[model samples]
Target: MMEAPCKRRRGDDDEDAGDRDRLNALPDSLLREVMSHMKARQVVQTCVLARRWRNLWRSMPCLDVDQDEFTTAGVSVVYSDHEGWERFEDFMDTLLCPGNVSIALLDTLRLHASSMGEDRRASRWIRRGIKYPHAGQEPGLQRGAPSCSSWRLRRLHLSNLYLCNLLAEHVRSRCPSLEDLELESCTCEFPAIASRSLKNLVLKRCALKGFREITSPPTEEPVYQWWL
Candidate 1:
């Protein structure tokens, strides 16, 4: 005798259901907090877990968008091929687009694209991170307007990207609330980086041939370790 095929238990089914729904039972604020610790792509991928998590990532306060996150499998292709750069740009655009992000709650935006020839795209993403709606209109109403009032953007970090003078100026003028800035292995042709609100600045292995002035009030001396 095969022991009557071992009847299924109702308690087992109940336990399974409870386990599946445990994450969904968490509050939205907690969920967003958890998403904030994750990479931008990992946060986006959580949408597939269930319908309740579909838009949870959009509410996250921090976005860490690095091309290296997507190049885990194809290092050489991502670093040397045009199509790889395009794919990275497209993925970043999808996350940084106004429609996909909750701009008012955003606190930090970090981008790392080691590939060359992506300066324009990097600048555009930086601009988007600093933009918000005007005062008298609904959110997302205005495009390319100063949004110091609506955003909480405090920390910005860029790595392995080229920064032009005009783009650097735009960053200084538009992101008035920026507190901490980090540039690593970047080529910046800007004459100056003057920010009234910036407190902490970090530059590592950066090319600053065009840099002439940094007008931030003296805080802790900026970390300026550059490798040739």
Candidate 2:
């Protein structure tokens, strides 16, 4: 005689149904906000969850593309395998492409790589995304300053990188919406940085030799936090 069909557990069925229903009920904006806090890879993986999530990442307002995320699950960043580096590059190229993300609403971008400047591919990809439209010539970011800028960039955080002397000028002239700037363990060559829109400046363990001061709005001095 054939065995009776196994019955599904009521609790398990309800729990699964509730999860799907709750996720599906959330508005796109709220979902996108939730996605902002997740890793770039995880965010992209959500596309396979359902039809509604297929294109949500394309308009995500904030993106954190950290190279550390590409490493092996339990490996330290220092001993990361190079195998995932190429994948990381490919992911960045696809994500940064003009049609991939809504550049108009992109206000925050945090790129964390162990040696970003040394890796030409990483720099090129960054330039490509930062350029947004033009993709031919190598911009000044490689040489010194970033020639291309985004009008919507409000917060910029640089860590363990060499910043150029013209960075201040570029921000003042190009990045009109910039408000927060943070540099950690970075080598800055700029003597002074002045921006009418900058509201917060934080420097931690940065090497400041000739660097003199930061010029910001007089109504209220930009909150300055420095750690030697």
TM-score of each: 0.76, 0.76
Model 1 alpha-carbon drift over 4 Å, by segment: 1-16, 72-77, 102-105, 128-151, 218-228
What lDDT would each prediction earn against the true structure? 0.70, 0.69
Best by lDDT: 1
- The reply for model 2, stretches above 4 Å from the true place, is 1-8, 73-80, 102-104, 116-126, 133-150, 165-167, 208-210
Query: In candidate 2, what are the lDDT values of residues 85-161, reduced to their tens digit?
Result: 76676777777665565333456766666654445345455444444532322233121223345446688776665
Q: On residues 135-159, what C-alpha lDDT tens digit does candidate 1 reach at each position? A: 2223544333344544566887888
